[model samples]
Target: MHPLDALDAAAHLAATDPAAAISSLPWLSASLADDAAAGRFARWGRSSVIDENVGAAVLPRPLFDELHARAGLEAAWPVGNAGLLHVYGYLLSTTPTPYGLKRERWLTGDLERACGLAVAALLPWIGAETLLSRATSAASALLARPDALTEEAEGRTARIALGAPLPDGTAALAYAVDGLIVTMFPVADPAAVRAGLGAPRLRWNAA
Candidate 1:
């Protein structure tokens, strides 16, 4: 299984799409080598990202998605902080196999996470702590800079760089500015990727 094939494949129990094209001792540095050549990720950037999520589409698609409305209403939490692994079908289907951060043409994935953050503000700490604790944890990510370049922010905190790393080690990076946090992954090179990979499904293109 190629490293980037995981880019297209979705959640499954038997998915064995490799993370690297060639196995290396330190797996982190080796990840982008293959995918970069094949263009698995649409962009690579180092912005003070506020919300970068892998399977961000797949990560939170179910919650705000109309399909899952019944389940969210039925289940105790999870859609927010109080979610439970279904112990069967859901655990397998929920996660996707993409390291690249994506924007749902319709922002389906973000809805759940935004709701999750709103309900429990403290949950953001989970990834931030992990990024601080383990330097290696963030090395392989799309927006890999764990620390903000700017020394002082405008207000409250020293600086704000919001990140969310899933249990799988795939994470999202968010930038905090003007005392506000927004969730759009920045692109390093606009020409490298397909035009609409990160753009809205319906967008105005200059004629």
Candidate 2:
């Protein structure tokens, strides 16, 4: 499917069932991407983003207003960390082996489903990636002495231009969810997703 189409479909899922979307990765990313394209963060920015892109309203009319409102503000419109973790638990709630990461058994024709499922799973990662890209771009621009950078700041913006944190080695599940969702759904943050299965309610044991 076309990338945007995939995103729209995922958004449809999210608009229909946000709780289910959070449980899956693919849906999360798609929904986030759609929402990001809209004017969710337009307020932070100096532009009207929502109206510019009508795709944000693809989902059922019921959620358009609320989602748009959420996006308008800089608040975490999409489910928060705990909600995301709750869904992640079900998606990766399978048996835990020596490795901490739980593995899922892929079924036939599940690639698309898996991709859909990964929307939520990978949004955090994708958001981090975007932040990294922006930071790198900003840093590069700063190093290049762009108009945005003035001598008054002494390139401090460039110095603090670290990209969003990625879940490379640490328990960056929060960041991971954002990055992973974007990776799959192709959206930014504060967006929603959908999944068929609910995340399992497994208890965590301390070491």
Candidate 3:
């Protein structure tokens, strides 16, 4: 099954039985509504819930991991490597708009930062033609950037450098339009992710 299919299924199940969904899935409820508001009944366990004092949404990593695992995705859909990070970043950073070209709220610094890393990770490996099929039209539209490259080879080697690290160890990689696989340095530690394998470069020669 496709990864998106699994995501859709999980979403559907969540919609049907929210309580059950939370129990079965990996998600934490986030309240975002304003409690001071006049009168509004809040829905529990909703991805996006609005109430008087606050609105809440569910932002959890387990959901992403479970959906990816269920989809039975192959190398073609490596959510772990990049897709998952991107999806998480987008959900947290952007607000859902009915007709906005880019559904994400670009203003949020944290979301923007996470998105920067996510883009850097996926830029090189993501097959353009492939993305068109998986990512929604709006996703594709917003994802479209001048820096995105297209080529048969070296697609995975593209590197975008997110120089220096933020207090939270966040950074962005900027790659040339050419082609190269830009590996996403793990967010856990900047130094660990940068340790090059140092394996001697291999070359093919006809004997």
Candidate 4:
């Protein structure tokens, strides 16, 4: 499937079956892991630490560039650490791991910082009220429906690419959903699929 088509399909999944879409996160991460183990996932940059004291996020250059370009903002603009954390938190939540304890610690430890960065990064585009509203709604829904996280669904797989370049001018991040391989920088377009479910505009601050 085409990249946008894959994106749209994922969006449809979120709209029709939010629980299933949420459950598919683990499979998506698994697909990413497989690609990474084979070196095919280099397009998605390596994970790095975000230092709150310095108020800077260490993101992949290409991913950063894509976000900047999409937002139509200058390179000098600060990337929102809270936004970055939100992205990370989502990833952590979706990751398939037996180490629930470790995951919980990591999320709870830095959730506030991540949310702050997210607001900073996204506030310009969506405004503070909208961003907060969307973020809260999303968090509430996911948290309220724990059963959604455990349900299973089935569909064919397609590779969808996000509109970002790697440092080497290759693809950025791509994951295999049930019927789509979604290629997108989560930071650039956080909660895009979920937003399609009438959540809110999670896409970067695009003016």
**TM match of model 4 to true structure:** 0.21
**lDDT string, candidate 4, 29-133, tens digits:** 343243334433222222222333223333334433433233233444333223222332223222223323212322232332332234234221123333223
- Top model number, TM-score: 3
Worst 10 residues of 1 by lDDT: 80-89
lDDT of each: 0.26, 0.27, 0.29, 0.31
Q: Clash number for every model?
A: 14, 40, 31, 13
TM-score of each: 0.21, 0.24, 0.25, 0.21
Model 3 error, position 116 (Å): 8.1
Model 4 local distance difference test score: 0.31
Best by lDDT: 4
After best superposition, candidate 4 residue 60: deviation in angstroms? 0.7
On the 0 to 100 scale, the lDDT of residue 39 in model 1 is 37
Displacement of residue 15 (Cα, Å) in model 4 is 29
What tens digits encode model 1's per-residue C-alpha lDDT throughout 1-207?
Answer: 542233223332213422221122122223223333443232211121112233122333332232123223232222311111111112223343342323221123332232223322221112223211121222223223455323332232322233444343333333322222222332233233233345222111100
> What's the lDDT for residue 19 in model 1?
22
Error of 1 at 8 (Å): 1.7
For model 3, state the Cα shift of residue 8 in Å. 11
